[model samples]
Target: MSNFKRASLIFLLAFLALPLAGFGCKQGDLEALRQLKEPVVLQWWGVFDDTDSLKDIIASYRALHPNVAIEYRKLRFEEYEQALLKGWAEGKGPDILFIHNTWVGAYEPRLTPLPPALTLPQLIDPQKGVEKSAAEFRETRTLTAQDIKNNFVPPVRDDVVRNNAVYGLPLSVDTVVLFYNRQLLDQAKLTSPPATWSEVKDAVKALTIQNTDGALLQSGINLGGSANNNRAPDLLSLLMLQTGTTMVNPEGRATFNERLSLDGQAFSPGADALRFYTDFARPTKEVYTWNADLPEAQELFAAGRLGLFLGYAYQLPYLRAQGPKVDIGVAPVPHLNTDATDAGRKQVNFANYWIAAVAKQAENPAVAWDFVLFATRPEQATAYLDRVKRPPALRSLIPRYQNDPDLAPFTAQLFTAQTWYRGKQPAGMDAAFRAMIDAAVDGTRTPEDAVGFGAEQVNQTL
Candidate 1:
């Protein structure tokens, strides 16, 4: 029999015991059968990080269920998805898997909903001086859609929930923040980083220096140009969100180009946001500093010549290692304004992280989900966060890590962090964003037309 058939039969027989035990059969008989049940081992595939990072957490799960073992394998990012799809097609996929938040829509068909709850046989007493037998215990526990919304950051709900079903859980979440050079700010006589786009414009003017040939000697910020710019799509998306541009509409169509009227004022937020972003690369604009000829943003930031670069927590260690002499500091991404009078203005950030999911091909879906829930629990999640050093996804743990030096900025923005569904072709959607920027910069299309064209292209992917 296939693994699925065998697993189905096993679960069916286990349920059959429930009715028998309910009909006056001795409970000890069921307990004995549970104790004699064969052990279950699960294969887990991951990306970006190694297995050693999770070895200790896996060991902790094994302590509770001595019969369960988890084998973890980390794959290269360039090859992960293709390998996973091929493996699943051959019926040899891992039991538990890690997938990108943006890829959830594409993988929904191959994923299994988390079991509501599960019962397991465990040892309760230990100090009896004699060996004690384990007993079957009922665990009436499940994470509901509401529980997910209440327990995690806001974007998590939109990313993991589908058709009112909880599909996955995230251990950590990352948000883009302003990575600035402390020394550069001091040189410009600025006491602190800019908190608004206008202030950033003024600061860039004061900080950007020019050479005799009109070439940039030191740039104020990294923005515009998609090929060499690091995370250009994320930065542009952040601006669109801050300007209240709904990238995707209720019908799953890309409608970011739609114009709006506010109090008799008409404007296209997406177009305005695109103009605000591309102006930095325009020589005619006051905020002009960077251009297509500049080095990569990350490299420029590490070289201590760039004033600001937008990045996530995952790059902290790398930035520090790459530039030991550079004095760097992190701050929340700038907002339009911090004034309370304009309460309609919302503060939004970009969210990027992986989620833990149960594969449909798993022979032991219930057991795999049990381990997932355990790993995300407060006690266990702390270990994973400490090792990974990413922002905590759980709401309760946010306060504890809010003061962390590397995590503070990201945690501060967790409540406001948001993401958009990029359809099944997320890469293509990102490419469309780049193409839109290119069209605007080349003057081939106005900002309004550029955004409309981009949305139309993305709609095709949807």
Candidate 2:
């Protein structure tokens, strides 16, 4: 349709939807709808999801408010950011968008914080004798900061809340889990996956296969450097967190390069984590099964050459499709050993997921935010999680998936799962980490020096 016709039709829609599911609304609710007297169209964009996954929820929401119409578009993740940037520059960006949880701070300037209250449709007054009767709605203060903290996991509050206001909300959360080949473990005489990093080291010895010439015939695990493994950053960060390394200080500066007192001795856990990780790739170390010469971690794991692969829950379907014949089993990501030598340490894991947020460009931000609340609430979110086969972020929904073979490990870890790196330069931060991993694995610099240098690089982005 031409621009003029579109504009005229929208004008008519605004007037026709005057009831807007508020025919029996109170005075205040009617006042709230004054600005919304115009047609409210919400354009939502997301990545790695299909329209069918959301069609039912959208239909349910639309059925409540005839005045509001939501149009959802799924974009390729690789091209999503550039598309958003370009469209935003032209004032044509989506009013609603799905962004990685870590991107909250970077994308905050373009987002609108949730309002204190929302005037929403509560019910539709349908009378068989009075066919013209419209729907009814009420104002609600159910989307408070405290409400978010109570309803969702701790990491959701950590990532989505700014100074005091909430900038976004999530429907699901995923954590890194140990994906191991059952056949490989049985061959190595191991009956179960490792429960601690120390066990992982010993298991690597039995699972590794090498010839007298010192050439690797098959690898035990995928770890060490970041060159070919896309998950290298998450794995390394997870290790750092588990070792009690503070990723960023209160001032938002990188502090993973600093030191702390361990057993009355001053040492840098960050550096220790880095050295421990690089040991797997060094020929001199006992856990020397991985090196730069090996194929990408995902590739090696799929071919059954790799014994254990640390990955997020979202990757399970892809791994299954890639290695259809590979018998895969999942276990909780190994934690710091809770033995006599290491006691009272916290259980830490890595979180990687996307969130739903409203744009500042939204013509009616209240309406946009209302949809966000409706979509993330328990009922709608549960339906979404059911369709997606991922872990739910809501505490109430955890039990439903507690026994699910593929989802249990991820859901169980949500209590302590965390994330760092909230800056705008996600790509630059990845490059700095890759460089740090290379220096330590290549013996070009000490692990401590490399970590310090990487921290400085990340500071520039802040």
Candidate 3:
């Protein structure tokens, strides 16, 4: 071959390889990022909230980055997981999605952990008498794991942060609080709500009214039995935690039924908690108030036949809709006051909420996570919380909502809210918890035996 022809072929090969070599280093180059500055669209999918609820937050983000477009879609809670699975399997899932806190462990593999910081270009200064941007500059914002821990509530750290990486962040966190009948308490001559388990027992005994033939005329507190009780697992979890049970260990093993107390007591707190929970359903117990034959707890409470029911923020609307004139009052969950000085005996409410996360397979993961970070900021989060009227997850905003009469009880519990690890199959673990309570309540097994059985079953799921 001629020398000139050979040289021409080599030049052609070099030209093709130039772009391939540049690809490896382009990600860190600001000029390369600025070159690909076309509008990028993101699809966001969520559950239990309509797009209108997030419209203001979305607009706030858009004002920061005009070139980014977000399309928000709301999915039904019952059908959300299957739809997400199908979409992801087909390589067409959302760039951002809402994940329940309990399911974070199961969904971690599909979610993109936020980076240490984000760098994006934004308009810096507008010309005088002009509404258009005159200058643009890159802005860098950083969020460390410590920042998340310091800014958000305790359970958010426990649920969202894994291995020093944040899996997601929530706009709000809801906790289970006591909902009691005002007229029933007034009828019983009790003006104040119960503040401790012993007080609850006393109140229940006073409020419960049984007819001559042993039929329950008015139930005390709708607890103990699993089937009819609302949020029975969460209630039981709160009991276990307050009684000094570690629901799961760092290794993701179910150790709730077998742990010693924080003071190193040689007793199973889970067993004790379970017994305390199921006592109200036992016929022989003085605290007996509910049974398996009773109607659903919410229905009974709404109909004004029940005294107290434990529920979260979401249950308020349902209860109001069911019986507007029921005259209900909300309070913090009662604690175990066996030792007043023992901080561990304080009230521990259950934290449950949805967190927004970026999909690992997202075309622009950085931008997706950036949007999430932007939305969860204090201002944007406040707007979202105002629309939802749920509990605030941020520590700074808790005090502001504390003065709100309707939200005070929930907001007060946010600092102390806790949740147990339910593993990959959270629903199945909760079912085991319910079964444990039911078995103990029915006298099929002793509390100790039931707790051990439930722990063993929950460990399998983990």
lDDT ranking from best candidate downward:
1, 3, 2
Summarize candidate 2's per-residue lDDT along 1-462 as a digit string, tens digits. 999999999999998788864554555444444433446789999997788888777888877666689999999989999999998899989999999987887899999999888765433343321234433456778466787889998888888888889998898999999999999999999978988888999889989998898887787778886887887878888888888888899999999999888679999988999998888889988899987778888888888899999998778888899999999999988877843112246788789999999999887787889888899888898888888889989999999999998899999989888898658877777788888889999999899999999999988886
- lDDT by residue for model 1 over 16-133, one digit each (tens)? 9998777555476356346535578899999976887788789999776777889999999889999999999888889999998888888888999876677655554523311354
Worst-scoring 10-residue span by lDDT in model 1: 126-135
lDDT by residue (334-423, candidate 3, tens digit) is 777744211354656778899999999899988898899889989999999888788899999998799887789999888788887778
TM-score of 1: 0.89
Ranked by TM-score, top first: 1, 2, 3
lDDT of 2 at 405: 83
Clashes of each: 0, 0, 0
Question: Candidate 2: which pairs clash?
Answer: none
Tell me, by lDDT, which candidate is best: 1
Model 2 TM-score is 0.88
Please give the distance, in angstroms, between residue 347's alpha carbon in candidate 1 and its true position after superposition.
Answer: 2.2
Q: What is the alpha-carbon RMSD of candidate 3 to the true structure?
A: 6.1
The residue ranges of model 3 lying beyond 4 angstroms of the native Cα positions read 1-37, 124-139, 211-213, 259-266, 338-347
